[model samples]
Target: MERSNNTAVTYDSDMQSADLDHLELDSAQKKIGLLRLILCSAIGIFVFFVSVPHNGDTEIVFSIIYNKLVGLMGNFAYWVLVLIIAANFVCHLYYKYIKKGSCQSAFAKVYDNDSVLHTLLYALGLVYVVLYAMKVNIPGFEGPEIIVGAATGESVMPSIVLGVLGIIIVGALFMPFLLNYGILEIIGALLEPLMRPLFKVPGKAALDAVASFVSSSSLGVLITNRLWRKNVYTEKEMVSIMTGFSAVSIGFAYLVINTAGLGHQFVKVYGISFVLVFIMEMIMVRIWPIKKKKNVFYNGHEQTEAERREDTKMSLSLIPKGCTRAVKRAYIAKGVPSEVIASLKDSFLILPQVLTMLSAIGVSGLILANYTPIFKWIGYIFQPLLILFRVPDVAAIAPSLPVGIAEMFLPVLLISGNIGAISVKARAFVTIVSMVQIIFFSETATVMLATKSPIKFREIVICFLERTIIAIPLAAAVIHLFF
Candidate 1:
C-alpha cells in the first residue's frame, strides 16, 4: 500500500513539472514576441512616417530608396518593366494553352484569372511598353499624335507604371514589419473609441489612412483588402475605408500642389485638404453604395452581437490591453523573413494585372482628357457650383474639376497654362479639389479594382463624382476664407 502511494506521488510531481515547463516556455515566447513587435513596429513607423532630407528633397525613407533606385537605373528601369510584362504574357499563354488551365501554380492562377477584356488589355500593355521602349511606332496601327507622342508615353511609363512597380515592391517588402508584427492591434485598440463614433470603422483603419498618407494610396487599399480577406473587417467597412480614406500620399499631394503652381501655398493648401478629406470621408461613409454594402466579412463570417461587444469592449487599462494583444499577435506571426517573402510574392502576383490595367485604362483616360470633349461636357455639370462660388476662370477651370476622374494629374495639366493667370485662391481650390477627389482611373481606382474587394467600377465612378461635388463648395469656402 505504501509503495502504491509513493508511485502516485511521483506521477503527480512529474505532471506538475511538465506543466511548469510549459508555462516557462510560453512566458519566454511571449517575451520574445514583445521584443520583436517593438523593434519591427519601430522600423515601420520610421520608414513610413519619418521624413528625412534626401538629395535636397524631404521625403520618407521609402521614397528615398525608390528615388535612389530610379536614379541608379535611369532608362534601364523601363526595359526591366518590359521584361516583367513579357514574362507575364508568356505565363498567360502557357496557362491558357499549354496547361489548359489545369496548372495550380500561384503565377498561373493570378495571371490566368483574367477576363477576355483584361487579357486583351494585358496584350495591349505589352505592345505599348515594347513600342515605347524601342521607340518604334507601328506602321498601320498608329493612332493619334497624343496617343503616340513621346511625352504621353513618358508620362504613363515613368510617372505611373514605374512608380507603381517601385512603390509596390518596396512597400510590400517593408509592410510586413508594420502589418504582421502587431502594430495594428495596438493602434486599433487605442483608437477604437474615436474611430467607431466618427468613421463607423474599427481603429485599425486609422493605420490604413496613415499608410496612404505616408506611402501610396495603392498600399492603403492593399492593406485594407488583406485585412478584409482575413475577416478583420466586414464588406461594408472595407468599401467605406477604400472609398473614403484611401488618400494619396503627402508627396503626391505636394506634386499636385506644385503642378498647379501653388507650391508657395503647399502647406496651407495641403493642411486644408487634409481636413476636407476627412470631412468628405465622414459624409461618404453614410451615403449610398458605401452605406448599402453588406456587413459580412470576406469569408462570409458575421459577427454576433456578443462577439462584437466583446471585441470592442473598452476598459481603463487600454494601454496594457493593447500591449497584451500586440504581444499575443506577434507570438503567432510568421518570422520576419518568411512574412517578407510572402508579402513580396503577393505583390508580384498582382503586379502584372495591375500594371496592365494601369497602362490600358490610364492611357485611355489620358487620351480622353487631352484630346476629347467627354470631360468638358461633364464639366458643365459643375459650372453652376463653380460660378456660384465666384471662382475665376469659370469656363476654363470647370472642365479641370471633372477631368480628375480620368487622372488626378490631368486636372492640373489641363489648367497648367492658366496657372500663371489664375488667382492663388483658384489654384489652391483646384489643387485641393484634385487631391480630395481621390478616385482616378490612372492609379488608385485601378489598384482597387485589381484587388479582390467587391467595389465595382460603377461604384468607383459614383464615389468620385460624389466626392467632387461635395469637395467643391467646401474647398472653395476654405480657399476663399484663407486666401
Candidate 2:
C-alpha cells in the first residue's frame, strides 16, 4: 500500500512537468511568429513609401510600374479605359435608373440619388464618345470642344487613366499588406498623438494624406472613404482629410508646374505651395462648416483598442505588437486577387462619376470663363485683394482666380502667356494659389460630390471659396518672402 501511494504521486508530478514544458514551447513559438510578421511588414511599408529612380526620374515603385504600362500600351490604354468607364456609366444608368433592374435591387435602393446622377452622366459620356472617340462634331457644341480636347488629349486623359491604374495595382497588390498586416496600425499609433490633437483626425489619416501625395488626390479620397467604412474615422474626420489634406498628387504638381512655365523653378514652386496649403489646412479645420460637422465614427465605435494604448509611452514591443495585429488582419483579409478586384470595382464606380460630372462642370466653367462676364463680376471680389498683394494685371489675374473652380489647371491656362505682365514673385503667387485652390470640377470636386460623405454641394462650393479666400493672401506672402 505504501509503494502504490508513492508511485501515484510520482506520476502526477511527471504529468504536471510535461504540461508546463508544452506551454512554454507554445509561448515561444508565438513570439517567433510575431517577430517574423514584424520583419515582413516593415519591408512592405518601406517599399511602398520609399521613392526610387525609374527611367531616370524618382517616384514610388507603383508610379514606375504605372508609367511603364502607360508607355507600353500608349493610346490603346486610354481607349480601353474610356470604353470601360462608358460601359459602366451605361449599365449603371440602365439597371439603376432606367429599368430599376431587380438584379441590383439592394444597391439601387441604397443609391437612388447616385443612379439619377449617373443617368445624367451617361448622357454626357455619350457626348464625349461622339466628340472624342468617334470624332463626330456637332454644331452649337463648341463649348465642349476644349473639355473634350483636354479629357481625351494626349496628356490629361492618359495621366488620369494611369493614376487609376496605379490605384488598381497598388491597392490590390500592396494595400492588403499594409492594412491587413497592421502597418497602418503601427504608423497610426506612432502618429496618432500628432494627428488627433492638431488635425482632429485619427493618426490613420496620415496614411491617407501620404497616399494622396504619392498617388493621386482621388486615391486619397478613396482611401478616406474606406477608412470611414471600416469605422476608423467619422464622417467629419473623413471629409476634413478628403478636402483639406488630399492635395493633388506629386505627379499632378509636376504637370502643373511644367504647364505654368515654372518647370525651371520647380523646387521653389512646389515648396511654397506645400507650405501654404498646410497653413491653410490648419486654419480651415478650426473654422465653421467643417467645425460644425458631427464627429461620430461609423458603427459608433469611437475608441478602438489600438487607439487606447497610452500614446505617451514608448517601448520596443510596440512594433511587434503592431505587426502581430497586422498579421491577424492580413490573415482575415481576402487574398491578393480579391483585393485587386475590389480596387478595380472602386475605380469603376468612381470613374464614370468623375468623367460625367467633370465633363458637364468643366465645360460650363470653361464656357463661363471664355464667353461671359460672370467670372469678371466675381473677380471684383478678389481684385482688391490681388491689388493689396501688388500682383500686376489685377484685372486679368482676378478673373483667372475664380476660374480655378472649373479646373485648377484653368487658372494656369488662362494666365499662361499673360503671366509675363506680373513680376516673377506674382507669377509664383498665382502658380501656388491655383494648386492650393483644391476645388476643381475636373477631378476633386466631381469625386467629392460622388462620395456618400454628408458634405453637400453648396458646402463644397463654400469650402472652395473659403480655401481661395485664405489661400490667396498666404500664397502672396510666401511668394514675396521667397521670390
Candidate 3:
C-alpha cells in the first residue's frame, strides 16, 4: 500500500516538473521571438528604406551595396549573367528531356514545369548573352548597334538584368528579416479594419503588399495564389489582390528612377508612386473585371454572405487584438538562420527562370521600342491625354508610356537618352505610370498566368489598358502638383 501511494506522488511530481518546464520554455520562446521581431525588422527597414550618402550620391543601402558589388565585378558581371542564363538553359533541358519531368526535387520541379515557350525564351536569353558578351553581330539579323549595342543589348544586360539578379539575391537573403518575423502579423492585425473595407481583402494581405514593396511583385502573387489555394481567400479576393496589390518593389523603383535620370528625386518619385499604386488599386477593385469575379473558394463553393460578413466586421479593440496575434505569431516563428536559408533557397529556385525571362523579354521589348513603329503608333493613342494633362514633350514621352505594357522598365529605357528633350516632371510622370501599370509581361504577368487563378489572358490585357489609362492622368496630376 505504501509503495502504491509513493508511486502516485512521484508521478504527480514528475507531471508538475514537466508542466513547469513547458511553461518556462514557452516564455523563453516568446522573448526570443519578440527580440527577433524587433531587431530583424529594424535591420530589414534599414537595408531597404534608409538612404545614406555614398560616392557623391544619397542612395538606399540596397542600391549602395549593389553599386559596390557591380564596381567590384567590373566587366566580369556580364559573364556571370551569361553563366546564369546558360545554367538555366541546361537545367531546363535536363529536367524536361533527360529526366522526362519525373524529378520531384523543388529545383527540378520548377525547371521541369517550364512550357516550350519558356524553354525557348531561355534559349533566346542564352543567345542574347553570348552575342552581347562577345559583341558579335549576326549578318542577316540587325546590326551590332541594334542587336548588341547601347539601345537594346547594352541597356538590358548591364542595367536591368544585372540589377534584377543582384536585387533578387540580396533581397531574398534579407527578406526573412522582414517576413518571417512578427512585424507583418502586427501590421496585418492592426490594418484589418482598413484593408477589409477599402480593399475588400483580409488584413493579412497587407503582408503581401509589403512583401511586394520590399521584395518583388512575383513574390506577392505567389503568396496570394498560395493563400487562395488554401481557401484563406475566395476567387474574387484572390483576383482583386493579385491584380491590384502586386506592385513593383522599392529596389526596382530605384532602378526605374535612376534609369529615367531622376535618381536625385528618389524619395519623391517612390513616395508618389507608392501612394498612387494604392489609390489605383482602391479604384480598380470597384470596377469591372475584378469587381465581376465570382466570390468562390478554390474548391468551387461560393462564399456565403454570413462568412463574408464575419470577415468584414471591424474589431473595436484593434491594438490589443493586434498585439495578441503578433505575439502568437512571433512565438511560433522559426529560428532566424533557418528562415533566411529557406527564403534564399526559394529565391534561388526562381532566380534562374526569372533572369532568363528578364533577358529575353527586356531585350525583345527594347528592340521593338527601338527598331519598330508599333509602340510609336500605340503612343498616339495617349497623346491627347498627355496634351490634356499639359505634360511637356508629349511626342517623346508618349511612346515610352505604352511600351511599359511590354515591360515596366522599357519606358524608362526609351526616354532615358532623351534627358535633354523630356522635362523632369514628364520623366517622373512616365516613371510613376510605368510602375502603377503593374501588368508587365516580363515577370508579373507571366507568373500570374502560370498560377491556376482562373484569370484569362484577355482579362490581363484589359486590366493593363485600364490601369494605364487611369494611371496616366493620376500620375501626371501628382507630378505636376508635387514636382
User: How high is the CA lDDT of each candidate model?
Assistant: 0.78, 0.64, 0.74
Residues 152-256 of candidate 1 have per-residue lDDT tens digits of: 665687778888888788888888888777787788778877777678788889999988898888878888877786677888889988877888898888888
Provide the TM-score for each candidate, comma-separated. Answer: 0.88, 0.80, 0.76
Q: RMSD of each candidate?
A: 6.9, 8.8, 7.5
Q: What digit string (tens of lDDT, one per residue) describes model 3 on residues 1-483?
A: 011211322222112111222222246656765676678878877876677887786767766776577768877777888888899899889998889878899788876556788778888888888778666333354436766778778877776577767766676677666655556556665676788788887777887787678756876776676567646578888988888888988868898899899899999889988888888888888998998988998877787766554424467666665555454444455667777787677767777777777778767867887799999899999999999989888888898888887778888888888788788888888888998898876667755764446687689888999999999889879888988
Candidate 1: stretches off by over 4 Å = 1-26, 93-104, 111-113, 136-145, 148-151, 305-315
The TM-score measured for candidate 3 stands at: 0.76
Tens digit of per-residue lDDT, candidate 2, span 1-483 = 011211322121112111222222134435543554576466556655678877687887766666676678754654655665566576676667567656655444434566455566656644544454433233354434554554333223445534555555555455555554446666766676677667777667888878777767776777777677666677778788888877887877888787677899998899778777767877888997888886677776454455434453555665664544444343334444665576556555555555555555555555566667887789899988888877666776787788788778777777777756656765667678888877776667766776566688888888899999998778777766777
Ranking by TM-score: 1, 2, 3
Which is the winner by lDDT between candidate 2 and candidate 3? 3
Q: State the TM-score for model 1.
A: 0.88
Candidate 1 CA-lDDT value: 0.78
Q: Candidate 2: list runs displaced more than 4 Å.
A: 1-47, 98-111, 115-117, 136-144, 150-156, 300-338, 341-351, 358-373
**What lDDT would candidate 2 get against the real structure?**
0.64
What TM-score does candidate 2 get on C-alpha atoms? Answer: 0.80
